[model samples]
Target chain A: MPDTPKRTVFYVSDGTGITAETLGHSLLAQFPEFDYDEVRAPFIDAPEKASDLVERIERVKRRTGLRPIVFSTLVQPAVVAVLHRAEAHIVDLFGTFLGPLERELGMPSTHAVGRFHGILDNRSYQRRIEAINFALSHDDGIIQDGTLDDANIILIGVSRSGKTPTSLYLAMQYAVKAANYPLIPEDFERKALPAPLKLHRAKLFGLTIAPERLAQIRQERRPNSVYASLENCRKEVEEALALMRREGIPWIDSTTKSIEEIAAVIMQHLQKMQKYADL
Target chain B: MPDTPKRTVFYVSDGTGITAETLGHSLLAQFPEFDYDEVRAPFIDAPEKASDLVERIERVKRRTGLRPIVFSTLVQPAVVAVLHRAEAHIVDLFGTFLGPLERELGMPSTHAVGRFHGILDNRSYQRRIEAINFALSHDDGIIQDGTLDDANIILIGVSRSGKTPTSLYLAMQYAVKAANYPLIPEDFERKALPAPLKLHRAKLFGLTIAPERLAQIRQERRPNSVYASLENCRKEVEEALALMRREGIPWIDSTTKSIEEIAAVIMQHLQKMQKYADL
Candidate 1:
């Protein structure tokens, strides 16, 4: 086989470029054989910035003897026209779909910039911030009276089974009010859900991990302690899984899953229960 | 006005569907004059799931007398084939770009599913989790000795000026170790930077919000108190801005900006300073 092909890829947009980058990454992940040098060109809402980006793309092309691959979500016509001058394979994320959408809807696009990620609606934005605050305050089983009533989902598992990160991700990404509780040894010994969680059974979701992984994670936090021992991890995980099964809480293994995947699973569970109708 | 062109929109994907939803939202935001009923169909990796989604789309189209719009990132050929059978305007996010990318790279895509948001790289995932922990521990100026040294960025601002949320966003989205410090009245009375922040001046970035917005946010947390008073808010903001300016720290107004916009601005600042070369 010839040497693995290499190319430069750019995720360019008028806003934060996060959508462009996210979609570009999903597309690129399908082709794992290629080596890509990724660059982010965000806030490129002006013709001058587009021109500068064109220059940079051209420089990469000249240096590599290959045209770069540009994934752009740019909406401005003038700025896009400037970028078209570059010697690159431009994947126009917006232009490709907007025309058909406009025809389908019988109207023209605003060609606006900074609208996707901006604080367009104050109420929704405030809701997201409030969700983040709720997640932070209610994290690690810190529950006040009637606080769990507001949570859209409550994650429960042994320590370091990946609750805090998932709670925050749910809050940040989808504005879901997620609180997490750790299933301590005391709860395991009693073979009953914590009193706070028992009152909110409908909102409870579980996360479990392989004992080895749990031990590895805990080792980093507290080495040479009973909490970090493999035997202890095994006992805790077994007890937690048994408790979740007994309580009929839906759960997924998080040992090899990202926070996004875990959160998506929990959201699907909520949807199935008809508790997240608006999500 | 033609019933605002009401129609259903679907974000379909083999994974979390977040990329499709994000890109679809950005595209639809440009055509803000129309009405949309958005739905998410995630984890549609198999042909059976795709067929189910197609059926749902057809039902929506039949009900509305218009074809539903679909934004999809499905990678499997069989799933894509099933989805194409739907009576809708399908925006194939991957199909449109992958063909050109394959030809450019002289290789076919792996056609694998669930790679983008999955935990593909364990080290990177762990880094993100660690970053989230760092953000939580160092939040609101809860700094221990030498803890600030590991931060990728330090956000300083008055309380409720959008520091905590911004720090958490940075950590969750980009694996950025962001720590935030509140510029309190004590620091302002001294008319100098906080002592801990004085040591790591280079990593410092400031956030300031409109006094009215700050007062409103504080009012939600503590009602009928001097801490939530508009006069106190105005004075605190003035002092914080003066201190940031005097200390030569760059800053942004977070009054109307989303956490994404704020994080993007901070990342750009770090890039300009050559501190975020890898990002």
Candidate 2:
């Protein structure tokens, strides 16, 4: 019993600690018995915050008496100075970046130099980029609101629908700020875009779940509720989709599709619209 | 140029977030016309920071008026209640935990269950769990006095010999509370582990890098110094590995192997040694 294998928790950062943690989480999920926790030390705005990051390395060293393996994103001298004392096994993510990009461009390491901030500067695909960011943020709102202003996109849909899961899928994976507002009874009665959403009518993308499937999901959440009844769900679905159509809004029927599929459909719609507008 | 593709950022908690980001990154990376920034949000501890987060989301939201994907591990009812009102997309990580675990275990949904609490029962694991908490809270001065009494293992090696990277890799990926200390001139001259480490000698793991690689890595920093010279690196590595051998200690030579290989080797070594001792 005592011989159970103890695990090592690693922190790998690709410059930003958040990216490393997100990627690391994916790696951990592949192996269930393993559990990895991450504490990000980002170097933005207050670069001085990274000075305290060394303290973090030390704290772990003290508490766990074992040297950890680090996949680090930091390349700054001051930060490296702090980490040197820790004597950890490190994988420099920036070190890997140079080779791949340089080779791609047929150039010698352009890191920190001339016209090379990567894709952080191009401005033509702005709308698609915005939609992607919005998609990644908010997932589950009982009231779905799909509009561009004050939203990555307003995700309007009924409860137990695919809105939350899809929105979450986008946000967690992409660092997209997604805000979803529900299409509630109040909105339906008023028969207009929610007041906050009225101004950005163009960015709206509606999510419609099948009435039968919606009932099934709701029943699982609440075995008995007027809210979960199939008859009630049917009426709501019929009304919501009709309203979206009448308002000249387009929506995806997420009934049988997976989360990825729903998101892809939304992305495609956004991309096509952007292209059309450009032309 | 004004219509360039935008950068999309994602703040996430698990593999799902990583997967989504990869797709999103691919899309943006493929279309260089867009400019967007992506970031991961590490696990946050409290609710007081809600507004600060809301502002970060809103800044991006207000500028683009498009939802940026914000994948959240924020399941705290209070935190969720607030973030729910934010202008960004909220991709909820806890939402997925509901689907698989609920179906498999027949359990209802809940949020913010500290992952450590869910997987451990034994005192040693609990101690490590606590160590992570300690590391998180006192990421400052925790390395002082070298009394990492709570540590399970200590890694030591010459500078840039891949110490920090390995330590973080172990900690973030495996959850091993690994603490790495550099084998510096002072300790090397004494031909022994640091004075503070003698008490916990059994928890030591020595890493020996090829003098050539060690020198090459150091050259990136100091450019040219006796300390960063091939001779010094060779001297340090030879001395350290020899010292470990003299003490009947086991060590890993990290010369040719990649970080992944070195970690896998160490994990296997730990497992085998644990088994040997158990028998």
Candidate 3:
């Protein structure tokens, strides 16, 4: 056996396990090297269920002769009891907030909601707030429309340039209103910023990615759109960048950066360039 | 002083804590009983940081004179040291996996993704799956130019009918791609499903809300769209529901149901009537 214990995350949520997946995936996405299995412990509603889950984990450990790390979000009397004998490294999500929550609610507990906050510079932080608003509000308009008034930073590129996923990540994580507009062939013909963008010249930022990568993402959505073509993607991206530079709008290449990395850079830029009252 | 012990949840991972929140929030949303202060022990990159975070949590316990619960994802030996003598409720995330994740990557997991598997059957369970699919897709085309094919059901009502928020909640939580089409005066005059929805006859569902509530939600956004008018709202909802009944399409008056409740009802309808693939 290896020197290290095997690790598994048990997200024993009260309902479906996807919510845990969202938080867990984002966390795991940060550490590429840390490999772990995901278990959605559904219907962990009662104290007995929590304790049972713990006991099961213990049995598995003794049977396999392997001690594994356990992560759980179970809040029940039985869960609290089971914790006493949990053999592996434990991360009790419910335990972290039991005090403040109990005080606030004046109850031993009934359900669970996690209150996790991250601190950032006020100005930079506000951009994230607006980003979330923008992302949630203007769905497709984010791509087809070029208005950046609500946007702290505008990501412009051709089809399949990794715009939508990146925008979503920023908005979901930081509440950043990251509006992304695709530079259609028509825009490329004149090679100018869309007229709506003329008013907000300073806040515009562009993103470009590898042509092959762009093709891959596009292939999944509209495999037949000419915009997804490598030649078309490359040409449009090149022209969009040139236009952004000529218009004096800054740009970032999204070729290698993770969604988190991209969001962090954009947040920093928005703070430095445009600190607007986003809400 | 509060009588309950100060509750603390130990959220641990080698990665950032986004995924934990997904599971954490679901539990919170479902239970709504347990409340806790949150501290994320994220970026426990190496064994040493794990030790430090473990120590800090212990200190928090000592300073507060309460035993803290630990939710951790410690996989390294150095990190396990901090867990020692912590005397906390430890829930390790990775403990569910019998072996290291690396060994399981290519291996088929023991768990089921629930496709084509025979299990206990219930209408509610079936609807939950359908609702989840609806929330997952959030098909924009359903709303574009007024096409409702993307939705298993069409919600027709004025603004503040809680259409958008409800649609979003269903889409995000259950993966249901519910589309809401605002029924307007023009819709009644044309006396048909809005132009876009005319084509999708089978998978259309409708909703109507109280005029006052419509005004409330609309007032928050545009505050002035004729769509917000209670009188207009009432007329449109009434007309649209009539048209739906005339066309042999069914609808629900959503004025009373919470978003989840509304989603639940729609899920039932979809399962019984529409043969939509869970794909």
Candidate of highest DockQ? 1
Q: After superposition, how far is residue A142 of candidate 1 from its true place, in Å?
A: 0.8
Output the better candidate (1/3) by DockQ: 1
- Model 1 sits at an interface RMSD, in angstroms, of 1.3
Task: State the lDDT at B128 in candidate 3.
Answer: 43
Q: What are the TM-scores, per candidate, against the unseen true structure?
A: 0.96, 0.36, 0.55
| lDDT of candidate 2 at residue B5, scale 0 to 100 | 34
Error of 1 at A232 (Å): 0.5
Candidate 2 on A86-132: residue-level lDDT in tens? 54545444443434433433445423311111335334233333443
Q: Where does candidate 3 chain B have its weakest 10-residue lDDT segment? A: B112-121
lDDT of 3 by residue, B108-134 (tens): 333211111113223333454345335
Least well predicted 10-residue stretch by lDDT in candidate 2 chain A: A110-119
Clashing pairs in 1: none
The candidate scoring highest on TM-score is 1
- In model 2, the Cα lDDT at residue B191 comes to 76
Off by over 4 Å in 2: A1-5, A12-16, A37-69, A77-89, A106-154, A159-204, A210-224, A238-250, A253-265, A275-279, B1-279
CA RMSD of all predictions: 2.5, 21.2, 10.8
On residues B146-227, what C-alpha lDDT tens digit does candidate 2 reach at each position? 4678665667777676655455445433456567777777766787767766777777777888888789867866899998
DockQ of 3: 0.12
Per-structure clash totals for the candidates:
0, 124, 76
